[model samples]
Target chain A: MFKVKVYVTLRESVLDPQGKAVTQSLNSLNYQEVTDVRIGKYMELMIEKSDRDLDEVVNEICTKLLANPVIEDYRYEVEECVAQ
Target chain B: MFKVKVYVTLRESVLDPQGKAVTQSLNSLNYQEVTDVRIGKYMELMIEKSDRDLDEVVNEICTKLLANPVIEDYRYEVEECVAQ
Candidate 1:
């Protein structure tokens, strides 16, 4: 079996209010050394095939379901299945 | 700047309808080696400082805003960000 890791993040042009809120909170706590924060989402998928073309499979997934191309960008990697 | 990675997936005990749907699709497409599929989300956070303690900061964000801890478990890493 193989494991796939997908990472989704906002396009740089977009604003992430949720991330900003956290950054603001941190700043309030006197972590002045901090300046900015952006939040993103991650996903893992376990599949039984590795012999197939992973790049094509991942491309199909990313465009079809894993991400909304309009606002988010996603990247993925496949590896041998290990400890869930 | 430092980037944080967070992953959220359905707790092993819960059923992932979306993942099941994908599994079914892959099977229908004749990818017989595939047996199961689980989907999770990934996120990255960009911050201006790494000099501060990252663990505590990430914990606070995960608990307070980034994720719903009741149903999700997350892991993160800090690295010198090379791109947006």
Candidate 2:
């Protein structure tokens, strides 16, 4: 089996309201040391061992469905996982 | 400066409807090799250099606001960030 960790973040050019709100909240909560915040998505996928090229499959899945190409950018890591 | 990356995921015992939906979609899309899916949140925080301990500050922020300790689990990575 394989464990895939995916991270999706908004494009730098876009404004993240949720992040802004969180930052404000942090500041109000006395965490004045925080300068900025950006929120994104983290996903994990477990894949049964197969002969398919894992990279190609994961890339296709990330682009086709996991991320929004227009506003978000994505990256992934794959690791071999022992069967339970 | 410090760059902190936080990952928040549902506890193993919790049901993730979004993950289930994504897994079903992937299967229908012929990515039958995928066995399971999980969805979570990723966040990036930029902190100004300060005398305070980054770990303590991050831990407090995460537990108090970033994650729900009851149903979610969180982990973080901290890296020194160069000024732009």
Candidate 3:
């Protein structure tokens, strides 16, 4: 099997209101050192061995369902795993 | 300055209904090779130089705001960066 770790983040040009809210909350709580915050999504997927290429499958999944291509960017790491 | 990347994930024992829903969605979309899915949060924080230890500040922030200690686990990577 293969384990894939995916990270989907907002593009730098986009505004991240949720992240801004969190940063403001932290500052209110006295964590004044924090200058900025960007929030994103992380996902782990377990895929059974198959004839299809792993990279192709993962990329397709990310583009089709895991991330919004217009405003978000995604990257992933794939590793072989022994199924449990 | 410092750039901190934090990943917050559900504990292994916790039920991830969102992940399950995504997995089922993928299956219905014909991505049957996927066996499991888990979803989590990824965040990036830009912190100004401080007298306080970086590790201590990050740990405190994660515990107090970034993660739910009861059901989530968080890990972070910190690196120095030239402020822009």
Top-scoring candidate (TM-score): 3
- Please, what is the TM-score per model? 0.68, 0.96, 0.98
Q: lDDT tens string, model 2, B1-84? A: 899999999999999999999999999999999989999999999998788888999999999999999999999999998878
Candidate 1 residue-wise lDDT, A1-84, digit = tens: 777777778999999898788678767876654567766765566666557687787777777766789998888878887655
Question: Candidate 3's fnat?
Answer: 0.90
lDDT of each: 0.72, 0.95, 0.96
Candidate 1: give the clashing pairs.
A40-B43, A41-B42, A41-B43, A42-B41, A42-B42, A42-B43, A43-B40, A43-B41, A43-B42
Q: lDDT rank, highest first?
A: 3, 2, 1
Provide backbone clash counts, one per model. 9, 0, 0
DockQ-based CAPRI category assigned to the predicted complex of candidate 1: acceptable
Model 3 compared with the native: what TM-score? Answer: 0.98
Better of 1 and 3 by lDDT: 3
Return whichever of 2 and 3 wins on DockQ: 3
Error of 2 at B18 (Å): 1.1
lDDT of each residue in A1-84, candidate 2, tens digit only: 899999999999999999999999999999999989999999999988678899999999999999999999999999998777
Candidate that beats the other on TM-score, 2 or 3, i.e. the better one: 3
Per-residue lDDT of B1-84 in model 1, one digit per residue for the tens? 776666666678878788788778867876656577777665566666656577887787777766678876766777877665
